[model samples]
Structure formats: structure tokens, C-alpha cells
Target: MSSFCLSKLDHPDLAWLAADRAVAADDDPTRTAAATIAVAQALRALGHHHLALTAALAAADPADDDTVRGTLHLQAGLAAAEHGDRRNAHDLLDHAAALADRHTGDTDPHHTGFGAAAVQTARSLAAHRLGDTAEAILRHEHVIRSDGWRRLPPEHRAAHLVDATRAYLDTGRPSRAGRALLDADRTAPAEVRSRPVGRTLLTEIIRGGPAAADVARLATVVGLTR
Candidate 1:
């Protein structure tokens, strides 16, 4: 699926596409921010690392604000890390973390972004990437507890759960990952819940059982034309 479809406003990589579309379509600031972030996220997911980085940079300096610049750096750094470019990732992440630190007096969760909660989640993701296990865990826990998350749309919540599951798996907590994935599947639409990762995780949980139907359904949901 296209990255635009996957990146929801409620999620951190907030509006790469919406922002861009807004500018292109009607010059709406709201759409511009959303489209820019959405497109940036989509590019990152599709492995267009440099494109993601560029998009983020452009979005950050729309009005040349330091805060927005820092946020974009944070996102670009994360995307770079995911693409296996640790050097650039570290540089960019450190830049953002530094800005966040300076502004909030130690990378405080209440910095600035789409929402306090979303900003905090982004910081947590950065910490997770930087191997700051304790901070990452604390921040993620806080996110789970916050009203912001509870008030999000179902698809947005599912996306967050997917990130949480990945974080759990990364931290060597497979059981937690499994449970989180199941929860995400429950909240997601059938089309989203039927992806390979979701299906495979479910199949593994119910090994040697009647989950073949589920697996098949997953294949169909993801439109695996094979």
C-alpha cells in the first residue's frame, strides 16, 4: 500500500503528504503540514531514505522555525536509522535530541509537535533507536497511559500498537510483542490486520491449529497477488 494510506495524522510522522497536497491543491497550512509529514513517512517506509530526509528538511523550514526544524531532524534521523545508516541517523537524532533538550531542559516529554503526546512518542522512538532502554520504556509507558492515545482513531491506535509491538520485540520481549500485535490486529481493519507480519505472528501463536483460515484471509487482505 502507499505510504499516504499508512501514515495517519494521529501518528507521529504526521503530515508529509497532507501538507504537500494542501500546498499543491489549495495552500492550506493544515493540509500542507499533514501532507508533508505523510509523504515523508511514506517515502521512508518505501525505503527512499534520501527522499524522506529531503522531504523532512523541506517541511521543517516551511517558515524556518527552529522547533519545526528540530522535529524534522528527529524524524529524518529515525528514518535513516531504520534504513541502516547509523552515522547519519546518529547525527540527525542527536541534533534533534539536543534541540529538544535545550528547549525542554533535558528532552522533556512535553516539548513541541503535533501534540504533546505525539512529540513524546517521537522522543521515545528516538531514545529506543539510541539504545536508551530505560528512557524509551518510560516514555512509551507514559504514552500508553495518556489521554491523547486513548482519544485517537482506531486506525491510529492500531498503528501505535504496531510500533509498540516492534519496540517490545526489539527489547527482547517477544511475549509482549505478541500480545501487542494481537491487540493491534483487533483494533485494525481486516485489510490492515491481514498483513504478513500480523498473520505470521498469529500463525506462530496458534501453531498446528486451525489458523490456516486466518493465514489465508491475511494473504487476501494484503492483496498478495501471488
Candidate 2:
């Protein structure tokens, strides 16, 4: 369920499916929390901040395993970031980093592929959302330049690059944003092709930059020619 959701994160129907799964799994707190995180993310994208925050908070559980806790905190941190609550976002992201530190053990069914790198990648995202474009790009650079970067899952890396593209655009570097989006597509075609934000970013680049011709090719690949 999560794999599908992650793959087609732009699909509103898939998010609704995950939310329904959460409802069906009322007897399982872990599943409920995990599902809620995905739902919250989708809701946030659709401009339902209030509902998204509520769903994100529902994922929290201090007593859960580190993976689950980290995932929940990550979602909550992202939601807070989107809400412009810089302080809350930073604290929650910090807590998620701590949990990720303790994740040198077994994997759980609820694992969202979050780890130290994921936490750091999340810093770039939160920073970008909070109008700290410089810090956002700087934080993402740490992840990209890490020795263990190659070991990180393609999906996670692609997500980071997508967020990095946003940071580039925010910092008035549309060409760089175009390059990052192209890099993201190379990293995970499904993630880029199916994500609304990815396509939206490409559209903005095409409409707002001198690199429109260069970005237009990739934009066509990402189905943005429509």
C-alpha cells in the first residue's frame, strides 16, 4: 500500500485509498499512524492544511518504535513547516533526527525509509518552506555530498532533489532548479513523472526562466506539455 502510495504520490485517489486503509486499520495503531502520514501529505498538497495537520498529529506516538516515531515526527515536522510554524517544525524535525539515530536495528512494517540522511534531507525541505532558501540548499548539499549518498534509496534521494528544485526556484535560480528537476527524474522517473509538485515546478521553470527550452524537454517527459 505504502509502496504504491509513494510511487504515485501525486494521485489524489491513491491518497484517499491510503486514508481509507487507515480507517480500516483502526485496530492497529502503527498502520493507522503510518497511513495517516501519507494521507496528511496528500491533503497538504491539495491545500487542506487544517485537515493535513490533524492527520499528521494523529500519526504521533511517543511509545512507538524509532522507525514509526521518526516517520510520525517527520510527517508532523513537514506539516508544521508547511504551516509556517518554524519553531515547531525545527523541534519536531530534531526529535525525528534523534529517533533516526537510534535506528541501527531491525526494520518495521511502518518504516518510511527515514534515517539520518532522511532527517537531514527533511531539514532542506522545512527550511525551503520556511523562506530560508540558503539554508535549504546548504542542508541538501550535506546529503548530496555525503559519502553514503549512493546507499540512500532512489526514492528518498529523488524526493530530496525535488525539494532542492524548489529551493533553487525560491533563490532565483531557475536554471539550477531545472537541472535539479532533471536530476530527480533520472533518479526516480516514477516519483518525478507522477508527482504534482514535480510537474508544477517544471511548468514554472518553463514559464519563468531563460532555460525554458532545456526544461521543456524534461517537462514533456514529465507530462507537463499539457
The best candidate in terms of TM-score: 2
| Cα lDDT tens digits for candidate 1, 1-226 | 2334544323324344443454477454433544455566666656677888887866666533445556677668778766667688778766776665555422323123533455566667666666765677678788878866664456656766666666775676666665666667678754245444555554443443343444445445545313
lDDT scores for all predictions? 0.59, 0.76
> Tens-digit lDDT track for model 2 on 144-202?
98754666779778878988998888888998898888888899976677877788888
Off by over 4 Å in 1: 1-3, 6-30, 63-74, 83-113, 127-138, 189-192, 204-226
Q: Look at candidate 2 and give me any clashing residue pairs.
A: none
**What C-alpha lDDT does candidate 1 achieve relative to the native structure?**
0.59
Model number with the top lDDT: 2
